[model samples]
Target: MSNTPSPTPLAPRRTVVAIAAILALGALAAVLILRSGTPGGSGAEAAHGHGHSEAAGHADGEHHGAAASAHAHDEAHADGEHHEGGGAPAARKSEAGHDEDEGLIAMDAQRMETAGIRLAEAGPATVRSVLQLPGEIRFNEDRTAHVVPRVAGVAESVAANLGQNVKKGQLLAVLSSAAVSEQRSELLAAQKRLSLARTTYAREKQLWEEKVSAEQDYLQARQALGEAEIAVSNAQQKLAATGASAGGAGGLNRFELRAPFDGVVVEKHLAVGEAVQDTTQVFTISDLRSVWAEMRVAAPDLPAVRVGEKATVRATAFDSSATGEVAYVGALIGQDTRTAPARITLPNPDGVWRPGLFVNVELTASSRQAALAVATSAIQRMEGQQAVVFVPVQGGFRARPVRVGRSDAKATEVLEGLQPGQPYVAEGSFVLKAELGKASAEHTH
Candidate 1:
C-alpha cells in the first residue's frame, strides 16, 4: 500500500544524473554547431578574439610611434635652422652664430659702420725692423773748449755771458795781470836795447870798412847786436805765451780770453773785478750746432752696430727724428752696465737738440721688402697661436690667421695667410678682436 500510494516515489528518480546528461548534451550540441560554423569553429573564434586584442595593441603602438617620429622630425628641422648642417657654421651664419664656439665677429653693414669696424686692403710694402736703444744727447766734445787766463790776473770785465753764442776770436772775458805787465815791460825794454844795438852795429861796420876802428871793436859790436836781438825775441815769446800783445801803448796788464771757435759760452767762472789765477778756467765754450747721441749697445747688437752705419736718432722730449750714421762703436764692454758704447752724430742747427736730452736711437737692425704688410696696430692675438687680422667680408669682417715676417713701429710684414690688395681692418682692429672674444666666451658657456 505505501509503494503504490507514494507512487513511484518519483520512480527513485536519477534527477541529478538526468540534469548532468542534459547539460552534457547541450554542450556537445554547442560544440558541434561551433565546428560547423567556421573551418576551425571554436579555435577560429578564439583566434578571432585574440586577433582583435592584438590589432588594438598594434594600433596603439603605431599611434605612439608616429607621434614620436613627428616630434623627432620637428627637432631635426629646428636644429638644421640653427646651424648649416650641425657641423661647421656657414660664413653668413655668423650673425646668429655669434654665440657659437667659432672665432667669428658678426655685424651687418650698418652695424659695422656704427661700430667703427673699418677694413683696408693689404698690399706689398717694406718693413723696417727698428731696434730702439736708449740714448742721450751729449755735447760735442770735439768742438768744446775751456778758455783760461794764462797768467794770474784780476778780471776787469766779462764780455760774454753764459749761453751767449760767439764766433771764433770773440772776446769772452777781460783781465788785468801784473805778470802780463812785467812781460810787456821786458819786451819793450828789449826792443829799445835792440834798436840801440842795431845803430851801434851799423856805425861800427862803417868804421871797420874805412879801417878807422879796429876789427875787434867791429866784432864786439856785432856780438852785442846779436845778443840784443836774441833778448828781444825771448821777451816777445814770453808775452805771446801769456796771450798778451807786446806793443800796447796804454795799460800793458790788459788781457783778454777769446773764443777759439764758433760756440756758446756754457760756463763763466769769472765775473767783473774778480781775481783769477793762471790755472783758473774763466770760460767754457761749446759749439751747439752738432750734438752726439750716445747710446748703450748690447752685446747681441755689436755686430750690427759698426762705424758709419746708417741710423736714426729721435728726441724723446718732442716729436723730432733725424737720420744719421753711426759714428763709433766701442770695442770694450762696460764693466758695470754690460754694454758697449756707441755714438751717432746728429745735426742740431736749430739748437733744438740740447745736451743731456733723452733720445731714442732707432737703429736699423734689419730691413726687407715684403709682398704684403699691415699696420702694427692691426695685428691681434688669436687663439694664442697665430696673429689675426680682420678682413672685409660681404656684410662685415672676418678674422684670418696670418704669419708675421718683420715688424716696425708703424707697419708689420705679413709673410703668409694674407694676399696683396686684400682689404683688412687697419686702424681699429683691436675693437673687433674684443668683440670676437666676448662672443667666444658666450658660446663656450
Candidate 2:
C-alpha cells in the first residue's frame, strides 16, 4: 500500500478493476493459443488457404493470355479455305508443276469467253488413227494419149488449141505431107491403069466369045486385068494408113490428125507451117474426168497404205478435199528416195483437180472406240506429260491429270481419269496453262 499510489476505498475498487481486466486479457490469449495448436484450425492452414486463392487467380490470368496468343497466331496462317468469303490456301511451290491451289483455277464467265476459251463435254467418240502422207496431183494416165503424126508432113492448119476439149475422131490438126501426096498419086495412076486394063479385057473377052481373038490372047488380057486390080488395092491401103480417106480428089496429100479419144488438148508442139515427122508427138490429150493423187509413203508405212483403203485427199492450194479409195500401191520401194508409192483415184467431175498441184493424203490406219474423248487441241502439257485436261468447277477450272490414249487430227482418246459428259475446255486451253505456270513461278519465289 505504501509503494502503490491507490490507498483509499476508491483506490481498492480501481485495483480490483485492473486485476479483472488483466485476467480477462490473459484468458482470451490462452483460448487463442489453444485454437492455434489444433490441427483443423492451425494458423498455417489459414495462410495456406489464402495462398491457394491467389494462385488460382494467377493461373486463370495466364491461361487466358495464352489462349489469346494462340488465336492470333492461327489467324495469320492459311486464309484460303473453301468456306465463307472463299478463303484461299497457303501459297507453296509444288515439285509436280502444281501449285498449292490443289489444281484449281478461278475465273469468271466473261473473262473466260474473252480469252477464247470454249468449253465442251467429253463423250464417247471414234478415234481414227490417220497417217498423213506427202503427195501430188497427177493426170489420170489411163485416159491420156500422146498423138503422133503417122506420116511426115508440114502443118497446114491447127484445128485444136491447147486446153481445148475434143471428141473422139475429131480433127486436131491438118498437114500437107509429101509422102501422102506420092501415095495418092500412085493410087490415081493405078486407077487409070485399071480402067485401061478393064477396057482391054472386055474387048478380048468379046472377041474370044465371038471367035474374034485366040484363046491365048484372052488369057493374057485376063491376067493383065488381075495385075491392075492388085496395084489399085495396094495404093488404097498405103493412103489409108496416114489417117486420110480419099474423099475429094482435089487435095489428096492432106493428112488429118484426129483425137484418138475424148479429151482435152494438154500439149501442142506443132503449129501452122511447122514441120512434123512421123515419129514426132505433136499433141497430147488427157481425159480430165478423173485424176490421181500419188502419195509417197515411207517404207515402214507401206503396209498400211494398201490398195482399197479409204483415203482423204486435201489440196494444199485451196480448201478443197475429196474422198476415194487407194487404187494402187507400188510393190517396190523407190531406189532413190526409199519411199513406197501409193495412189488414190479421185473423181474430178468438175475438172478442178489440176495436175502438179500439191496435196496431202490421209490414210486411216486404225479406228477405235473411246470411253471419253475431246478435241485434240484441248490437250495441254502438265508435269512434263501431255495428259492434262481442264475441267469445269464452280467459278473456275481444274487441271485434271488424265491417261491419254490414241489421238488423231481432230480428236483424242482418254483411256482413264475422265468421265463421259463431263464438261472441259475444248479450245484455247493454252491460256490456262500459261496462267498456271505464272502461279507456280510466283509460289517458288
Per-residue C-alpha lDDT of model 2 across residues 190-233, encoded as one tens digit per residue: 99999999999999999999997899999999999999999999
Judged by whole-model lDDT over C-alpha atoms, candidate 2 comes out at 0.80
Clash pairs, model 2 backbone: 80-87, 80-88, 80-89, 81-87
Error of 2 at 225 (Å): 7.5
Where is model 2 more than 4 Å wrong at Cα?
1-124, 189-237, 248-250, 377-387, 396-399, 425-445
Q: Which stretches of candidate 1 lie over 4 Å from their true place?
A: 1-128, 368-372, 375-377, 380-386, 395-399, 425-445
Q: Where does candidate 1 have its weakest 10-residue lDDT segment? A: 11-20
Ten residues in a row with the worst lDDT in model 2? 76-85
lDDT, candidate 1, 122-174, per-residue tens: 88777877788999999878888988898999988888988899999887887
- Per-candidate total of colliding backbone pairs: 3, 4
TM-score of 2: 0.62
lDDT of 2 at 440: 72
